[model samples]
Target chain A: MKQSALLDHPFGARYAAALPAADAARQDARETLALEGLPGPKREEWRFTPLRGLAKIPFIPAASADDIDVCDLPADVPRFTDAHRIVLVNGVYRADLSDTASETGLTVTEAKTPDHGVDAPLAVLNAAYMSGGVTISVRGVVAKPVHLVSIGAAGAEPAAFHPRLAIAVAPAAKLTILETHHGLPGQPYFSNPVTTISVGTAGVLRRYVLVREDSEAFHLATTVADVAADAKFDAFHLGLGGALVRQEISVDFVGEGAAVRLNGAYALMGRAHHDFTTFMNHDMPNCTSSQVFKGVVDGESRGVYQGRVLVARHAQKTDGQQLHKALFLSRGPQIDCKPELEIYADDVKCAHGATTGELDPDHLFYLAARGIDPQAARLLLVQGFLADALENVDDAVVRDILSGEISGWLMRKASA
Target chain B: MALLEIKNLHVSVGGKKILNGISLALNAGEVHAIMGPNGTGKSTLSNVIAGRDGYDVTEGQVLLDGQDILAMEADERARAGVFLAFQYPVEIPGVTTSAFLKTAINAKRRAEGKPEIDAMEFLKLVKAKQKLLSMPDDMIKRALNVGFSGGEKKRAEVLQMTLLEPRVAILDETDSGLDIDALKIVSEGVNTLRGPDRTFLIITHYQRLLNYIVPDHVHVLVGGRVVASGGKELAEQLEAEGYARYLSAA
Candidate 1:
């Protein structure tokens, strides 16, 4: 591994020079990134989603771009009633636009450079150039949800930003967080976000993420969560817009009787590409994990879902289930699905299924016979297909918000 | 002129002839029952009239209110007042029954230059219609026909027919999966919708359904063409003797 790998890429010396003085952790991450560069097609995890197109772009540090400014929340951003607002522009927190009011049992502070031993390429990239983010801690039942909105903008030239977020729930505590990633349209910008979460024993955490970046922008996010005994972690990720986007989530069950429900849905059109990669590590006995992912692709777009569940030899009574279903609106779109289940325990129950199909003609004809036009019929069917995954989101408000985003995407595709 | 007319219609599936020059005409305020044995193109007639794909008209004219409707697409024909009560209605998951009903009603209304149905008004209308069919109030909140029983699916079809109020309504094998009670309930639903402006084309293999709805005319179809036509008594005669005579004649 030579330093030329990083030098040849956009995030070499120039990106490092613009960043703040680094600590030992950041320096170690930068040296690792310089050694490995970005994951390429040879890496099995990155095979489906190649970063060649992303690496070719000469992107400057988003912090160095002084022309970009976001003074207010975007008009299209849905206002979640009673939820605390947290706004981030170009990866940096905006105090003026955010709601800094503190609530009981909940704390929010500027995220520090913590040594999270994550070796993934993108996670390393996030650590190497991490600019701004927040750390939210829950000590007791937090009644109100926290809404974190990340906004990205590039002026004159392509800009890149990396944000780090950490969340910790104390024993027997509960919390819910919603993340919405959006950006302005101009020169293509790149957003790299890494989130680390920990749920204490007997605790509960519900995290919902929605990504609708500009069509010309690039977004790659990674989330790692650890669940303790008798804890529950429910999460849903939705991807609707972006030229290229990938959401990777990894969950590690560290105690018995823990439960995790990870579900996601994506709707893509044009040349947009979206990918979801998940890893479930069942290291403790009596832990259960389930993943239901569904997506709809149109135009020349591409959708990918790669999920791996590993059960340790001692982790008996592990229950893991994963299913991926994709619908293609036309002949041009492509779907790649890979589901891997490794059960070293003899008493584990693990099942995985993947399916790709077009809209059922009978369904279309049924709607058509009822006077619904072909376009509207298609839209209804697509929404119905993705609704299976959306139903997994237990929170009604969050479900409706994601549904609205998917509906918006469908309407845009219908007109296009 | 007849409210719905089928004149010298010929249809084929996979280049194989199914309906061989079959024709029928239903005047305003009339229920015409087409009784035939299996493989006699009974379903084909209903599908062709409702504009289903994979069927080659080859040669035919299906007219609604004196206009040839074979040129219109399925949805266009539906908006132009054509409805088909499918024997096996498709099960569409995740599409709530209420949402589907509203979309259909709105489509018809939009085509007629009327405003869309408001949420409250739509719910009220569906509730009223559901009561007429003895449907549970929460049925509309479930996915469209996804988990419905056979009887419930048939009743839902009648509910749609009642809502859309099409000029020409075709019921294909609507009695196949219904029990006696469901049949009576479904027939009553059809009876309530029969009026001077509407005509019904009931396509069934058995004459049991006619006992409730009481068609004005009954035609015996065999081997893709009508072998005989007569008054309502024709249905009773077939019910007693079966379609052995018609099959031999064809």
Candidate 2:
């Protein structure tokens, strides 16, 4: 049978016909069409993550606008009043639920086609039938941060949702954006999201993402950020709770004097799985970037971190450092980390390192010898290991919120 | 009654005897110094008393304050008020000294069914002890002994010892890397904690530390055994004459 016919069987024929025109990208997608169920052990990245439920769940596009209810923001959730807020419910942007205005130098529109070299099948699928996605642009410098909130609500039936967002920061402009993923109670769904961000010359942008999904939920997201000359981008990611999640971030430094700092922390327990994959490309000179990611895995959980820094020949003086470390709290738990640096320029300073091990026995002994219980000692050591990455977050309120969330998660895991 | 009593202790590491038939008794309000050469099993005796793992107590009974401590784990023994000032304190990165000390103190307190100490109370206690040890406030704020000078590390160990307030403290060559000033400061800290309820075992290679903290009893450890025991005068004799005679005899 032809590849298109296989994709047509589960997801309608029309969806399969909308595959990307890029032959190589489509071929790669087609070859994996037989993966009707979750990407299993056969897939390299999904080897540690369980996804059988995601593969077996029938694929259904988001329901009509009236079928989804948009509730008021929970009191516990922080709000940015001055900034424009765009809310997406179950992969569909709800205009009635959002407070965005096109006249405010920001526009929210549905993308007709995957524009600007987005040839991946997932991107094409998001483009072909995506319901609600906003195109946010700051014509000039904007004083306020733009908040984009995407939420996945559980429906009565097994469902899947794909949310797409395209962002463009104009020259010399600054933007701070916050994105959160929340699963409604009884909402068992699969969320596959793709966001593309472009920073113009001398622009600055800070993006904070918090992912707290239900344990039964499956989340797959990819973020592509491109930086122009003299631009700076900082991103902080916190993965607190997820059944199985893989977040991939790719940043391309296309112009000289551009800089980026990527920091993330993942605290997971139970049978949950969380993976973070980052790829940084330095194509211009005098560009700098650093990434510090730490994870704490307990119970039967698993964590994976794969980071790569690529420096081209012309990308000289590209100071890049990547460090990934993980602490395994239980013998049944495991963490796999791979940090790689491929440098082609002699003048560039690039280094990468990865370490995965259990908590230090000596530190534990030291704590215990001081009269602390074994459980509390483990918690303290885990917190110390994650402190460096947590301190990297510049916003105090956000940092406090993230820390509290992580502590709560850990406490619950310890009790459970 | 003695606060700590070791009877016929025989400890071996990796199938080699390090402490053979060693015995000692420590009474409250008393300091006993054990002076010996480098390979005289001074450290092994301290470690064995602290219940360090992998040290096979082939034949021995370690009693702390009338309780058999050899059967307890390291932490249990610590809670029972036995502390070992490590010769080389382990450096823990990313953990502040103050936070570590507070956690340790509270851990012990909590294990004893006591309420946790408040933040202000902890700060007050730390400040008072810092003044006693003449340690800078920054030393407590920095990562646990990370990037600290050798003398600073030794001072930090003394600081912990003062805060934990163990009933029987064993200083295992803590003066090895200290200068005269640091040695005096550390000894002063130990002296301040000295009381009728507390005892100490100072283990060192030279009698230099003995000058600062005079011991009531001095024992010459040779060939994994206490070859000679005498009053404080024994330390002076060993200091005037070196370990040359003892080394040759062993």
Best by TM-score: 1
User: In candidate 1 chain B, what residue range of length 10 has the lowest lDDT sum?
Assistant: B241-250
Estimate, for each residue in B1-250, the C-alpha lDDT of model 1 and write its tens digit: 9888899999999999999998898998999999989998999999999999999998879988899999999999999999999989999988989889999999999999999999999989889999999999999989999889999999999999999999989999999999999999999999999999999999998889998999999998888898899999999898889988777767
Cα lDDT of model 2 by residue, B127-179, tens digit: 98998888887788887888888888888888888889999999999999999
What TM-score does each model's chain B reach against the true chain B? 0.99, 0.97
**Which candidate ranks first by DockQ, i.e. highest?**
1
Instruction: Please give the clash total of every predicted structure, in order.
Output: 0, 4
Q: How far is candidate 2 from the true structure (C-alpha RMSD, Å)?
A: 4.6
Give the C-alpha lDDT of model 2.
Answer: 0.78
Candidate 1 regions with alpha-carbon error over 4 angstroms: A1-7
Q: Which stretches of candidate 2 lie over 4 Å from their true place?
A: A1-52, A62-117, A133-150, A175-178
lDDT of 2 at B122: 92
Model 1: pairs clashing at backbone N, Cα or C within 3 Å: none
Candidate 1 reaches a DockQ of 0.83
